[model samples]
Target: MRRRLIIVLCLAVVLVVAARLVMVTRDLPAQLTGAHFEGLRPEPNRLRAFLHRMPKGGDLHTHLSGAVYAERLIAWAIADGLCLDPAAMVILSPPANAPAERPCGDEAKVVPIADAVAGWRGQTTYDLLVDALSMRWFLPTPAVPSGHDQFFSTFSKFNPATGGSDWQRTLARTAEMTVDQLRQYQAENVQYAEFMVTLLEGEDRRRLGEAIGSEREPKAMLAALEQSGITAVVTQKVEELRALVARVDEMRGCAADRTRPGCGVQFRYIAQVNRNGAPAEVFAQTAVAAALARAAPSIVAGLNYVGPEDYRAARQDYRTHMRWIGFLAADVPVALHAGELWLGLVPPPDLDFHIRDAIETASARRIGHGTAIGFERDMDGLLAEMKRRGVAVEIALTSSDVILGVRGRNHPIRTYLSAGVDVTLATDDAGVSRIDLTNEYVRAARDHGLGYGRLKRFAFAALEKSFLPAADKQQQEQKLQRAFAAFEQEVTDDLAWPDWLAAFARALLPRRG
Candidate 1:
């Protein structure tokens, strides 16, 4: 009799919750639903603001160097006492009157920020550097001319500012960058970010390469590499990364106040392999990434392979690279950038296998880009398998449009969604692409027909598929659920409707005579 009463009480509580949810949902603007999402086409600003306030659980795909805006990068360059090449706008170490590459001719000067501060031309030069360092300069009347080339080229222009050879300086720069980025993301209500951070240097690369030299057998190679004292090197770097993460957390006041802006964000790093490097170079970096992740799982959560997929080295060694990752899959989490190519960008055959190899071979839990999944062999089967395996695809809608002219109907977002494969929207290179996580959500809603609920699911999936440990994941999930509930109730409380938007919503509903 007691058990029956308990069951009856539980059923009544569920009914009450269900009824309350229906009432709350009814108070929300009808346009927030999948059916009415397309109607937001005309109110771009309004939709952007709405999504900005939406709780984005995490950004699973982002590059640290590519996340910071060019303007801030320029300021950092100036403060670092770096000089700028006026013609190419490249930042480098300096002497003001140093000879520069031609095109600016013999008169070209590498102006120091201190020197520039005293003159208007220096300030003008600073303004111009911002454009040269990012897509901000591209006057896209139609589209950016050679955007693919331009996008990749931006990295080289800012590389000198990152303090090469000095991993400590790199860590400092990264810590500083994270604070800035975390503030921005938190303003958009993002709770977490997993930055693709590179931790290798020339010496470590050479050491690891020589140790694992020309070993054909995977087991032998793994054994030889392990015996090579590479773990000692990785340990040092892992300590550096941990220190950096701690410094960044302190800057965000994470240790003092969890509720502070940017403090609430849980940031982690992923060691990135430069996919365009030579076979030895690639494998060595992979070894370091795998080892480092295992050594410092808290600070360095996983590993990723990053580079243009169409590059000759990355293209030819694609399978070889996947196998390398496969060898370490048991130890490291893989998030490979595969199928970032499009038609005419590479031979059609190239697109067919990149994502599949990443999935079937590397066992990547998350696939970044996966843009060309439609062109893969047996597309339907692949989609089914992805769904079965629970491999989520990180979709960067804005970056896709900027790089491949693929967006809206041309994008496979709907295809993935319909296939029951989990899809999470991200800002791949918000700095380079001139976008934000909020804007990506807005684009997905406006262009790809994702409603508020679908957007929420994507946000949740980001945290769910993250490299965070099980316990931390559960804690974050609980916090995120609470945040979402609070946000929904706030929205439901008054609808927060402005007079114009309320009228707009009413117009979409049936009229009463």
Candidate 2:
């Protein structure tokens, strides 16, 4: 009798599981039909939800400072005991002398940290600061002229809030900011990000430049730059980078078998050389980046040229900077910011050669912006080279619209695609631009009429063209492919069944019991 009872119980367990599996399988066909029907729309709400659920391969063009939103920056500032100059919308390390000007109200000459805190305590004051610090609540006002100026100018306003380049705090702050960004990416289903992180600036940068001196030859310059004690400077920054990577990994539980959302995603840093600086400074910065790449290959993989592309120094020494990059790129990789200008934004001559030079001279593996590709001399030839070399262009659709006022047909996305060049979408400054990776896809689909298949290819290209090593890139690609298959299964085979199927399963299952 005991043996019979155990047999019956085991049979009962098997029967229940079998019944559940049958019910799940019976409903799959109807579920797939519904999904097929819903997949036809290219409009907003539906498409946004679709892309949001889709796996984005990576975000290859995000900036660290511009990735953290304003509200968080303010919170960080307050926590750091930093005061706000509400009048100028700048965060300052407490007033040194006092009584320069009032923060919010004109009544007080100087606003104490306590006063600043109290002022921002109100929702309205906080919102005002958010608007000033980012593109949030942005409107064309007499005081603020163009959206382009407003977009770029936010960096200056929040520079003090980021605590500047004070070595003791810079790494910790950057790591925390990157962690926040990783959370955002995970929420959006993005699996990777390459941050354009600037780890050195101010006196440290100046000191490094002095050490490197003024050698113009690539070989000799690199040799001199190496022996100039610049490695000590780079070593200090590399230590910071290691600490940052370690903190992020810990927060994400990277070493554990089951990691959090943050750890599920991988992050790599690309050191950005400040293009607005002088030639020697640019060389020094490049050398430092090369060293970082050598010392911290796990975290730092590439170098970039970052700044206002239309700035005088960047335009004047454009080729020279590319030469510096080309020299370093023999041992490292680069993704340069080129052709960010528009027709009227800079001289026509500036627009004609940037994209060409970055590719031909710098041998940049990737091009960020590439907005002015249409204006390049021998545009056809350039497109062919891009295709031949498999150089991917990182398009930030939202920022392009805000800064260059280029969207829809005015944007060169179709040109790149039609020319057979590899293209991927990125969030140039998600926090500042108030947009995310999904927004880029949505814009690409809605405006450019990109189908689901075309969009998925963009995601694939992101990882394929990334700076990750061969084995890592292959592994990431496989992971992405798996994610896509699972997504398809969830939407097509596991969706809610039709009413008739659910009713049929319910009625049939009970009768079987």
Candidate 3:
């Protein structure tokens, strides 16, 4: 009886200690931020400030080409002495054998970009070009009736400024663009990014397509590519990318003692394959992308299919494209632009199977846009499979709303979360959408009613689902944890009363009388 009594006393003591420990380690920051978030809905400025200070982990679905602002592109064009077609708001190459006095040629139809930007119609031309390059103040019209058309067409419109014809100039422009994006991300406290970029171009790209001509069998095509000295080309492309990275580092002053914020942020690339090309051309690009990924796994992390998914070539060759990706990317990782469609955008049958085929056939580790998840057949089953396989969906809220008209309750973000599928917020084309990562988090909280805790999960999900290596991922996870802790403490500190005010209140309190 005495021994039993002693044992019960010991159990009681242990329970008391455990309770004390829980109290000591309670998350005061999370609690404080939760209260702050609850009160922020009524104030837009405060809401933006709060989320802006919050740490965003990474953006995994960004397109490099579409991420540059129109103003910067125009500046580059002016520096190159390029011409502009004011009617189309498109940049044109300088004519050959052109006189130095008129570098853009003496044609009345085209004027120098510099002249257009500073002439009598300067402001008007500038505004039109900026609006044309992005979705700002857009409305349906006779020429470009759909948001979809306007969004995709912006790429070709600004292609000349992005170095459409000159390979050396293209490299320099790409490096400058990358540095610009990284610096922007750093200002918002984003720790990492995986940019989707197209590395092959010009004669090299043409030669690879010819070598892969008319080959239907995946293995045979891969074998032919191997025999066609594609390795040398891949080597050259890899070196070019390395040079680009070095240029980005130099521009950002990464090697200096006093470095820019962007110097600390980690970045990787995913080679892009254009889906609007001919079958052989598409296959050739895919093979080259796979080779690039394999050759430089550290720099080129993976491959993705870009271009509008509903294009004539993309829709007709969807299955074949999947097969190509499935076969060529056996060992490499893939993220596909699947189910970016909507009911009115395409025929009903088109939406039914895209997400499924991408997951089941192409082995996509991540799905971009995924706006048509509701229209996809076996919605519940597909969600289940995605959950089972750990496939993450990259949700671009602003881009989807602007380009596909998918937002609010109509978006499948809630559905995916309810079904236990992992989802992360991204900026599909930050410049094109005129938004950043913070804008996406704000949209999630304001539009979808996501609370602080749930939004935090989305930030962490981006890092966990990134294609970064395991060791690098772990390092980034640690950095994210530290950033959140500091951010939450700042919020709590803001809520605290001033020490002098507290003393004054204490002095005014009633005495023990």
Number of the candidate with higher lDDT, 1 or 3: 3
lDDT of 1 by residue, 367-471 (tens): 998889889999999999999999999999988887788888989988888999998888988988778999899888778766666888898999999999999
TM-score of each: 0.87, 0.85, 0.91
Please give, for residues 400-433, the per-residue lDDT of candidate 2 as tens digits.
Answer: 9998889889999989999999999999998899
Ranking by TM-score: 3, 1, 2
Q: Which stretches of candidate 3 lie over 4 Å from their true place?
A: 1-25, 497-513
Candidate 2: 10-residue stretch with minimal lDDT: 504-513
The candidate scoring highest on TM-score is 3
User: Could you give candidate 3's per-residue lDDT for residues 151-216 as a string of tens digits?
Assistant: 998998888888887888888888888888888888988989999888777777787778878888
Order the candidates by lDDT, highest first.
Answer: 3, 2, 1
Give model 1's TM-score versus the native structure: 0.87
**CA error at residue 428 for candidate 2, angstroms:** 0.6
Q: Is candidate 1 or candidate 3 better by TM-score?
A: 3
